[model samples]
Target: MPIDPERARLLFQVISSCYERRSLILTTNIEFSKWGTILGDEKLAAATIDRIVHHGRLVEFGGESKRMGDSLMLGRQ
Candidate 1:
C-alpha cells in the first residue's frame, strides 16, 4: 500500500524538530531494513532513518509473547 504523503511530510517535520532536543522512543515490529517497504518511499525512509539514528541507541529484545504463554499455561492448569 502507498503511504500518505501528507502524513509522511508531517511525520518527518516532527522528527526533524526533535533532533537533539529530546529523546524519541518508538516500538515497532517492522525492522529498519524493511522501512522503505512500509514507508513506500526510499528517500523518505532513508531520511527518516538518518535523522533518528544519528545519535540514537538501538536496543533489541527477542522472545515469545509473554501474554500468549501465560494464557496457554493457564488454560492447561
Candidate 2:
C-alpha cells in the first residue's frame, strides 16, 4: 500500500529537521529506492534516503514474514 502524501511529506520534514542531532530508528519493508513511490516524490525520497543512510546502519533480514507464520499456525489449529 502506498503511503499518504501529506503524511509522507510531514514525516520527511520531521526527519529532515531532526537529522543527525537526534537518533531515529525506522523499520520498514520498503526499500530506499522505492521510497519515492511511497512518498509520491522522487526528489523527496532521495533526500530523505540520503539523510537516513548518512547516519544510520542498514540491516536487512531476508525471510518469510513472522506474521505470515503465525497466521499459518493459527489456521492449522
Candidate 3:
C-alpha cells in the first residue's frame, strides 16, 4: 500500500474534511516513518504525518503474519 507523499497528504486532507463534516476511520499496514519511506518525499510525508497525528487518537500494535508457515491454525480461518 505504498503511496506517494502528496497522495498521502491529500488523503489525510480528505479524511480531515470528512472528520469535520462526518465520521471517518483509517487503518494502516505500517508505521508513520515507514509510510514516509514508502512515500519517497520528505516534506509532504512530514506534513502528512503531522496531519495524521494532530487531534487524533492512536493505538499502535503489531500482529504476526498468519499467511506464513505458522503452526497455529488461527481457529481454522
Which lDDT tens digits does candidate 1 get at residues 9-63?
7778888889889889877778878878777778988899899999898888889
On TM-score, the candidate that comes out on top is 2
lDDT string, candidate 3, 5-68, tens digits? 5686677678657654665566877777776677777666676667567757787765776664
- Number of clashes in model 1? 0
Per-model root-mean-square deviation over C-alphas: 2.7, 2.1, 4.4
Q: TM-score for all predictions?
A: 0.79, 0.81, 0.56
Candidate 1 regions exceeding 4 Å error are 71-77
The sequence of per-residue lDDT tens digits that candidate 2 reaches over residues 1-77 is 67888998899898998898888889998877888988888998999999998988999998977787778667931
TM-score (C-alpha, index-matched) for candidate 2: 0.81
TM-score of 1: 0.79
Q: Who wins the lDDT comparison?
A: 2
lDDT order, best first, reads 2, 1, 3
Clashing pairs in 3: none
How do all the candidates rank in terms of TM-score, highest first?
2, 1, 3
The Cα local distance difference test for each model comes to: 0.81, 0.87, 0.67
Candidate 3 segments exceeding 4 Å error: 4-9, 16-23, 62-77
